[model samples]
Target: MTVTRPPDVSVVVAVHDTMPYLTACLRSLVDQTIGAGRFEVIAVDDGSTDGGGAELDRFAAEHPGLFTVVHQPHSGGPAVPSNRGLDLATGRYVFFLGADDLLAPHALERLVDAADHYGSDVVLGKMVGINGRYVRQDVYARTDPDLDLYGSALPYAMSNTKLFRRRLLDRYRLRFPVDMPVGSDQPFTIEACVRAERISVLADAVYYYAVRRHDRGNITYRSSPAQRLDTARRLIEFTAGLLPAGARRDAVLARHFDWELSKLVGKDFARFDPETRSAVCAAVKSLSAAYLTGRILDRLSPAQRYRLALAARGRIDLLIQPALHSGSAPLVLEKERVLVHLPGFDEMEREHFVFNGAFDSRMASGIRVLEAAWSSDRLVLWIRAPVLGDGAAEPAPLGISGVPAEVTTELAVDGSGTTLCARIPMRALLGGRRHDIRLAVTAAGELYEFPLPALGRRLRQRRWHRGRPYRISVIPGRDEQMVVRVSRVPWRRALLWRKQ
Candidate 1:
């Protein structure tokens, strides 16, 4: 009798018209350093019209006993195909990979090794965004052997891209919510993490999420505001039902409020049609009434809380005031209170709209880093900030350790704003550490710290310092903050580089 052992991992890819990107994704999977015997790829082509099914077949035919290609009619979303693939998985651990995304060469091996070594039922590999996609990264700051799902930043990154033990999943009968057009993976991943005995996170670059420059067929891109709101509401309801109402539940629900709910009231909210806007307001009001706990509200920034409160009260007119104020709303300072001057807010209602804390960076304007570059071994940031009365106050670098703010030049000054040049020596960022850059200034006697927004995707610099080489890059965070990562390069790899 012959015995066949299950593969170490089963990668489930739900595909739909991914075309050129699909080829790269499949190729990355087959070329994994873990070897074909260690992992199997189960691809479900969800009624792709764009030859994606043919591409999958070609790969399967070329690599026998490696790929399992399944074809099914379009089920309107990825949940159907992902569930089917999960049901067919025969490996000890299952990983859900996006058809439009690919993995690092050694991602599977590292994930499997970490999972086995830590005896974890779930493992999350560090994911980087390519082609301008923003993936939340706070959870991947370090390699944690045992991560707390509710106590940590895991809630912010509840995508189904992580590895899960098949046994744990089957034990709980976990599956994606098929009824959701978008964000179905959140519920599936959240439940798996909650049920798993232990969860691990790997800091190594494991997944590359690509955002197609011109592909609107992506489900998230195609989903309407209403559809996304409905999905968010459903997710909130699911989360509320999964856990008892308290700090633990509030910790999880905070993600939905900050992202899904707050996103609905962004600058674009003003552009939504009247009916759609009204519907969004009504839905937000209902959700807030049902769930929005004080703990969750406290977790939100004052700006976010105010915006959601207005939306919940069906104050679409007041909600649109911030967007129409040219991003710098009128500020009133009475003693320690900083109140926002919004139209139609009476004296009684005006107090409710006051900034929760002494600082509200959201209402501050012109704190953007228009350009970042290297000059004379120094990192230069051209910052735009509002000019206070008498043009006295200037934006200063804050929170960065051992680095002093050097405003070399006041580039320009106008009634709208002032552009200042801030320079920091690269040496200040050595020691293989990361630093978050924030620009602080005073407006209307109120101090605000704003995250520096980079104009481009990411910026990088390579240099050899103190007989060791380092790679410095400015990464744009998912929450619009900019991060500076300074990493030491291996000697062997550093030697291979051409001399500058």
Candidate 2:
């Protein structure tokens, strides 16, 4: 099995003890729609004791020139094997795939096409999580044929599951940091992005990132908090060193703070020992002090802003306060405003304490529900929130966050009032998971957000779709307001719809 000519794409798969999923993963690669001759698989078996090495050999032998196997002693991580694969790659472009993951049928073809068309040094294929959770593909919300890593939201797609031109790698001398036990890919991906002149995005291409059920062997699930924090600090330092101070640098730092460091102050923060908690808080505070600025903080969500501020100030007690009062405060919607009454935080006395704005403007500007109905047959829910005042400006063009404006609803004015309504098909809104839907309105050229008030507890309904029961209840928010909670039927019947 020898290569006479360069291939279109070189897929580098680093495998350890993933025997159960290796077969499917290998099969997916060999049967790629991009054609066997166009691509090659360089499977690195990292001293797998689970017969994954034998599986790799068998695939390589069967595929002949299409598959190559590199057997090496276990390095305790994917970085070493990945670098080895890079050394052996001969294709014009390179792709790194996890041995447990699978690629969509046309993933390679789509990526290659985008790269060729834009002469891109890197092309990011969309990633889909299987039996695992993933961040929303907001980075791919809109397509940009020619994407700038620093300017665009491309930094958020920092995973190594992308197509890279071999030329770019050689030019920048990019390699994964073998010293890192976790998140080694972060530095490599960040460097590649920063150095590459042209990076294209192929939103339609899919890379299935599979999560093993009941298996804690995955490196991500096995890393200790200290190890992760160390990796995060290294990554932040590496990324910060690449870019100068400005909006671009701030954007990247914002993602790290909001997504990675912010986890230290999450609900699970209480589970950590005092020492570990203090170490995490210290690391977060130090990083934030160096990189986080008002511009970056201003763009984050209110919850994120609150937690980050507390962490930066070393207010561990205040940081954990929200978790202690979790679901304790009932949301109150009165006087055309939504309020969450934290035990210590005074809502009435403190100005700008509550999340209120044009939605509760004194000039008779508020939404009122005129009618509500759900059709199980069509899987659509209809709600009419009409403008109350006589001179109201067409209900301020209502929209729902987490939902596309075009598909969420429509606006119409009838004799009753200025109606803001939508025939929201559940299929469109329910993305196979529970989502918090916030109402957004553009009033006087400014956007205002309000929680979609729950119709009423008694008005709640249970509907079935495709043999599964979905409980649509009007739950009170932690703040004073109503939110529609659409959830699957609880496994424990007694705990179904219990008040939070």
Q: Against the true structure, whose lDDT is highest? A: 1
The lDDT values for all models are 0.79, 0.70
- Report the C-alpha lDDT of model 2 over 117-140, residue by residue, as the tens digit: 888988887776777645458677
Model 1 TM-score, 2 decimals = 0.72
- Structural similarity to truth (TM-score) of each candidate: 0.72, 0.67
lDDT of 1 by residue, 208-289 (tens): 4555536556676778888977988888999999988989889999999999888887676887889888988988889999
C-alpha lDDT of residue 117 in model 2? 88
